[model samples]
Target: MSAFSDSEIAGLKVARQSPLIILQPEFVVRAFTLNERLLVCNPNGRLDAEGALQHAYFSDFTDV
Candidate 1:
């Protein structure tokens, strides 16, 4: 018997859609999840902006 239902598999596929990059007036960021791990990035070409992306990605309260 299959461990996961078809609906659950479909949900997983939907959740794993291609990542997107978000550009804001103050920062640029891209984020996605694979398996159970969350991956995030920034393309602002600044150390602080990159750091902020990392911080937000790792923070426990981050919604995304």
Candidate 2:
């Protein structure tokens, strides 16, 4: 990812599959791996990629 601040990210535009919508959140981003797996930031936190997807926190922010 580029060295962009949270504000910069939020100001930028990102295309979504549902062309009618967009996700330009103004907050810190959660990094992910090349294989589309979320990186583990906390050892005690949920470490399962498959499990994380089931949570409500999961969002379709993956850039096409």
Candidate 3:
């Protein structure tokens, strides 16, 4: 059988749909492919200097 049949293709399309939503100026949401997400989310992954600094700065603030 083929890898993806007609019904499976339709489900895949639905699963990949992303809807835009607005957030506060300081916050953002992004979408990534499975591999990209895995790399970024990996426990062993390291953040670059700039990213680390930004994360540190943001870590000090609370929404309230």
Candidate 4:
């Protein structure tokens, strides 16, 4: 997947039919995984935003 800036948040639409893994330039590839939640990381395994998975899944299934 390509990298996106926070500024592009407006046009960003993630597909919920499948899971999405968004990695920061600092994290290791193996550092990303799905544990019933969204995981964001930096050079050190840090959490930028959690619950992203929830939002995507809900939005996909929602009427809105």
lDDT of each: 0.41, 0.46, 0.46, 0.41
lDDT of 1 by residue, 1-64 (tens): 3657866776664344442343232222322322113322543433454455455444554653
RMSD of each: 10.7, 13.5, 11.2, 17.3
Best by TM-score: 3
* TM-scores of the candidates in the order shown: 0.17, 0.21, 0.22, 0.16
User: Residue 44 CA error for candidate 2 (Å)?
Assistant: 5.8
Clashing pairs in 4: none
Cα lDDT tens digits for candidate 4, 1-64 = 3446555775878866633344333232323333223443452453234444334333444553
Q: Better model by TM-score, 3 or 4?
A: 3
Model 2 CA deviation exceeding 4 Å by range: 1-23, 26-37, 41-46, 57-64
lDDT of 2 by residue, 3-64 (tens): 57766988988865642223533221332332233454664653575666553345554431
Tell me how candidate 2 scores on lDDT: 0.46
Scored against the true structure, residue 61 in model 1 reaches a CA lDDT of 42
Give the C-alpha lDDT of model 3: 0.46
Q: List the residue pairs that clash in candidate 2.
A: none
By TM-score, the better pick of 1 and 3 is 3
Candidate 2 structure, TM-score to reference: 0.21
For candidate 3, write residues 1-64 as lDDT tens digits.
Answer: 4657766876764455453444332333322222343467656675555554445335544541
